[model samples]
Target: MTAPDSSAPLGVFDSGVGGLTVVRALRELLPDESIIYLGDTARVPYGSKSPDTIRRFSVEDTQFLVGHGVKAVIVACNTATAHALPLLQSTFRVPVIGVLEPGVEATLSDPNCERVGIIGTAGTIRSSAYQYALAMRKPGLQIHAIPTPLLVPFVEEGWTDHPALESVLHEYLTPLLDKGVDTLVLGCTHYPLLVPLLKKMLGDQLRLVDSASTCAAHVKTLLEAQNLLRLPGEKPTLDIYLTDLAEQAEALAKRFLGSTFNKVKKATL
Candidate 1:
């Protein structure tokens, strides 16, 4: 067990650079606490993998972050959050939070939201993670899920907007728009890059829901609930680790993290 007074970083890990979105939101909300982020870039998209593979990778990712002295961990990938959250929470000694549950809670707690649509990769949509969570929270709410595999690769390429994006957005989102969804959940972390285009595609009639901000707020609340907030006068730090792809990692880091990080290092795990 970790020591009670441990001042270790809180860990967040995802399958690729996508999780930088989550890290960005967390940094804004908890400016005084250090964060350790791990991106298993070599494996890239977990959206195509099987449940067993996702669970294995998730456990390994969490274990790798725990080795870096994190007191808590967040599974920032929707796929992992769907398939591996239970394993992570039960196996890890520290508190483990997944993006899916908190995001569902946020959507459900907001009374204005009645019909919600979800856009994500195949795995997240197929897992029906968001739907299950939403049904549990608000049994009668309508939920639509559309699988979007292209968005992840687009975001990874640092191409947030292009002529191709609009067509893709319209193709993937038109059904949800026609369904008259009031709130659309950007179910994948990578989807945030397309917020502007998606909003335009859906028009002012539909509201875009970002799980990143909600998940970050929940992280803050979780820390406070457990009395794990950072100590006074401590200089907050952020350490980023990735599996190879140093250049892509750096570019996305700058895109989401806003500032250049001199502390980023490459690691296999």
Candidate 2:
């Protein structure tokens, strides 16, 4: 049942549809919460942009969602989380969560882990975002970074497995393996789709961190603490928005949300 007088939906934004993985987790875990997801599809990959550019894009995205009566916003893009999380939290009135902090928290809390590696787009690798977060939590942490640009494109094309995909993963992961890191953080939301290929390459010894799931757990806690938890009744209504409307977003919605989505509202921000 809808919460009496509930006035807004939960807002989520990513540079593109990759963040739908986070949306999928949210819908399965909190079925009653309404969600408004905005994908900056026109500028699909924020991973190569400068921090200034990412922050500006994130701010514009947040403003668009906030205008639509969002109770909270999730910065589902890793690049945005790295660059714009603090800005979003301070600028917005409602609770704002990002994928970075939660992933860092989870990795640090795992006592079995020693050295950690991060694979992301060039921008994320250049920012040293994951390295800094991990270091901040556990001082003297060994960190390695590999900028895996091709993985994002493969994900965009929905090609998780192809002869080309394996070639790309091998080429990208070579440096991280040389660094001998034990835990690999799937820094891009789209990266979850590549877990099987990554596992085959890295073997069972190296753990791949699913930042989206960690972020979802964090959202659950943050909402509860703020008295914003959605009460259960019927399934949640999730609305997807994209700067460039695409059939792909609509097709992928069910995989992420665990239910068929009828509405994918288009937007430009």
Candidate 3:
């Protein structure tokens, strides 16, 4: 493995377009750093796949990014991180970070945080990664986790404001609300897109811990510590790649990335 250079782009990948939220956060927090994002649209939603399959897919994804000579790789997919982070870190020479630990740390940062609610894909919840991490940090803390499999599709459909979405959200959040959870962890990257609606529905008392922003902050700290931060004043670029581009890929990318959206190239992995 070659020595990591400060000017090299940061590589990020997910099972699909949701990882763009991480890219969006990175662009805001580390404007001087360039980014290379890979969305495996061809095999989107690794949530339902077996752990072995998820690990294999994640290896290929990391291989593709490492081949591009990135300074570090960020596993922006919650499912991928839950299942394959250790393997990827061992296999790759560059620094490998995941979205899970940062979010967990952020969630527990508040001393008053007692009751917590977590919502993510079925696979992420089933893996118990977040639950385990949180419990390990704060013993006897009250934690409630729900598998919000339906929320992802609604978010992708751009129906955050739809009246029907309110009902769906209500159904998913009632258990947590009943348990009196004060902090809510948005476990999936796609969940950040619904923050506005979530705030309006859940109100101000419930603190929302967005994994995307927390992960970006963590990335910045790590890069700084390793002396790999790109120098300031140099215009940074964001290159996007996808294993397969669906018809709605561009539109969905725009939704997740907002103004940071760029033309995506096809990645043969």
Candidate 4:
């Protein structure tokens, strides 16, 4: 397959609207590059799915993006990244980027951090991707992972600070705090929305690592290194596609991207 032109849009896929955080970062970092984002809302929350199912969904998402002539593909879902990144990288001709390694890199960057905590969906936690990556990088590093599956739904519902949500957060984070974790990685893109609440609860001592911006910076570096960076100072088009119709996706896209998306269409695998 021939490499796409520099002007070709970059593709980004996620299980749902959570990937918009990545899109926000990409737009801030690469203002002139067009983007094609695919959200598999029809099968949202790959966090509970089997590894095989995640891989299959990721492949279809890649194919859908490739069909649109994307210059590269970004797997913006941590769950999908945990389960399917290697396969996506090997199977696709375009560059494939995942959220896991970038977030892990960010987490390990803090020199003072002795114990690290990670919070994500069940699939990501079950995959143990963060633990394995950290171990491979630093065998002696201490890591703790907790699955906060309910957080996704809470974020989607715009309930970032509901009393019930706080109860759940306390329940999920108390154990990690007890473990003396000085740094916390928001392992899922959706979790960024809860940062304010998290900071209020965890306080200043606990550093929060947001993968969205880190992954975006990595994408910029990769594009520049490959001589695939687009021209600057131009307004770029963003094409939005979802496997199923989701009103919240559009609303959240506007919230995260800081602009209204004029075109959103339903797609199928």
After superposition, candidate 3 runs with Cα above 4 Å error: none
Better of 1 and 4 by TM-score: 4
Candidate 3 clashes between residue pairs 3 or more apart in a chain or in different chains: none
**For residue 10, what is the lDDT in candidate 3?**
99
Put the candidates in TM-score order, highest first.
Answer: 3, 4, 1, 2
List model 4 lDDT by residue over 181-232, tens digit each. Answer: 8899999988888889988987896999887988998899999999999986
For each candidate, the alpha-carbon lDDT, in order, equals 0.84, 0.82, 0.94, 0.88
Worst 10 residues of 1 by lDDT: 1-10
Q: What TM-score goes with each of the models?
A: 0.94, 0.91, 0.98, 0.95
Poorly placed runs, candidate 4 (over 4 Å): none
Q: What is the C-alpha RMSD of each candidate to the true structure, in Å?
A: 1.6, 3.0, 1.0, 1.4
Please, what are the lDDT tens digits per residue for candidate 3 over residues 153-221?
Answer: 998999989989889999999989999999999999999999999899877869999989999999999
Q: Which wins on TM-score, candidate 2 or candidate 3? A: 3
Error of 2 at 54 (Å): 1.7
> Model 1, 124-238: lDDT tens per residue?
9999999988988787899999898888767766677788877888788788888888988889887777887776666688777777888899999988888888885778888
Of the candidates shown, which would achieve the greatest TM-score relative to the real structure?
Answer: 3
Better model by TM-score: candidate 2 vs candidate 4: 4
